[model samples]
Target: MRDAPLEFVTAMAAHGDVTRHDADGEPVYMLHRPDLARHVLKENGAAYTKDRTPDDDMLRPLLGNGLLTSNGAEWAAQRRMCAPAFRPAEVDRFDRVIVEAAEHLVAHWDGGRPVRVDHDLTSLTLTVIVKAMLGTDIGVAGEGFGRAVDAVNRFIGHYVPSDDPDPADTAARYAGFHRARTFLDRVTRVIIAARRAGGAGDDLLGAMLAEGHTMSDADLRDQVLTIIMAGHETTAKSLTWTLYLLDRNPEAARAVHAEIDEVLEGRSPTAADLPRLRRCRQAVQEAMRLYPPVWLISRRGTADDVLDGYDVPAGSLVCVSPWVLHRDPRYWAEPDAYRPERFDPDRAARLLSHQYLPFGGGPRICVGRHFALVEATLVLAVILRGLRMELVAGFPVEPEALVTLRPRHGLMMIPRPR
Candidate 1:
């Protein structure tokens, strides 16, 4: 388990690209080869589905059969129906909302004081997505609501079904998942019904209704919960990592601010301005490369599959660590360094296909990838340009692979006025 980050990386490096081992009797293939990754994620994708039982077991209770966890026909159909909601123009509509959320964070900050970045960015991303993706304002709404979701994410992230636990304790966590999920379900249902009746339908819920494709309440719950949780969580962690990286590397922060100065000239960045904010984009990309928000992408081989002479039996578990691949010493120099320039023009050009799995690969790649990039770009533009975030000295910020590659102890920093 990469939950033990050091052991996981050392193991991956030991085998170079592909390694197969028995895990409590069943075969587990840890693949690092780029072409092989394409085989599993792109070319021979049908042989696999995102149904690795161990992780999805915890997710099923929260996500239902949403796009993130569904397989086969259900997955394909839902992908089509939800495509329009994330189309360029639809996501473009949320530009102002992203900026507003970024600015709102800056406004609340007192400057030069230690800030709990994980909490702040989570609140900002949650608030933005709830408004922009769902057409509802859950602005800094409930500290408890955010805290509850964190508890569920923690339980799911570190949970290993194989490890037997006390039945009483397991039941309590299950109860917690339902408690948080029920609240989210109510919120999603409200948006769904309102949109159906021609009410507050400005986000994806609106777009779905406008298309006349109705989903049963159960399906709707799954979709909304999937979008809200999956949609906001990854981007939030990515943003947190980006800021933390920039804060510690003043040179990278200078380059980021320089790009903002040259491009936006002291104004909030818009979609059109994104292309020119090269350094900002690189900083974010590099951060994701170093600490991908969703650290592990796993699937189950539905049919016997072979890659590079290695046989992967049907029902076997396959895993790809963007965290591992991005840092593979074979491909990346100084695999552990935080240098945003690694993503710059000359360097990015030399990168290979599956060498970067920040958003995963191929057809089943995250549908929200574009929207996430846009939101992250805009938020980075606003904050990285105007603020200087310094990590609280002596605070150890390390990756704790959970539902996301969250900072082990929430990223603590001081966001001083630039």
Candidate 2:
């Protein structure tokens, strides 16, 4: 499972829509059917809890009881408090940051040489999230900030579900994780302290630390770290995969290029322009369908429950995988193909709830769903308008099923002006 986790889970789809196996005495159920996914993630979601589950166990060390790992009333309160910051008005405010950052990265690209799209996008999205969320320039935190995040991701990539206790952490990996955690903790503390001293903030951080808010410094740290990490990492992976997919499919790439040319002419994209960037947006959507950033969603049953006629014992671990569901031949036509048109507005509208959950579903759906789509679409537009990335030949790109689905060795591409 550790050597090839994605492959191991994907192989189960061959058996049936629902598969069960034992891991250290616990029954692990993998749901491949959308209806079943809905049962676990939505309709009967109350029966499952993220708290203390495999996902929370792995992420709690880093995220604490942030919205992603919290449960019940605690999760509800956090979600409500954070909702105002992600409203339409607030997300629109982030467009300029996304485009400007993408444009900045484009300016640095060497058109003639191979560029690491994954690495550059990671840095770009990190910068955007920091500036947009906390109103601070990540640059001030130095290069180690990005390195620390990378180290954390590397350590997390080693995670595998087991009923037994986690194996002893490797010395080098644990050291890297510690440094990353410490650096992020210190940075968030400084930002929060400065903001508190400066009085009210108009950004996400300020709102969370506003007057009368019950969030202590530690609580703020968890929420801030969760946003900074969740906000940037997934979007970066989505863009990287979008570019890689477009590069692999010439017809799709041309469609995106033509759409961008017609829509923007020579100007940069804004939030208003998002509605018309159809093909570019669809490309991003399809890429996520093929390689969802959050490939696995883990929860444990809080009580005995029945799903799809199967008796789910209390304490059973249930997993809903977008990776497996997205490619189900039962729902998607030519499931393995890079066909962005699959996400054409009308066609996409026909998709059932869990059939295409790049951002998940139900009450606990990703709070930043709109923000992520807007950011990815606009960033893709900004890039396609000024440059085209050509995937290096035989680069051997493979998806590493870590905390996010990432190109295992980084995507090497040549940036050519469009």
Top candidate on TM-score is: 2
**TM per prediction:** 0.93, 0.96
Over all chains combined, what TM-score does candidate 1 have?
0.93
lDDT of 2 by residue, 45-143 (tens): 998898756678678888887888889999999898888888888999789999998898888884568888888888888888888878888785746
Residue 27's lDDT within candidate 2 is: 77
Q: How accurate is candidate 1 locally (lDDT)?
A: 0.80
**lDDT by residue for model 1 (333-382), tens:** 99888988888899899899889988889898889988888898899898
Query: Which residue pairs does candidate 1 place in steric collision?
Result: none
Question: How many clashes in each structure?
Answer: 0, 0
lDDT at position 214, candidate 2: 87
CA error at residue 234 for candidate 2, angstroms? 0.3
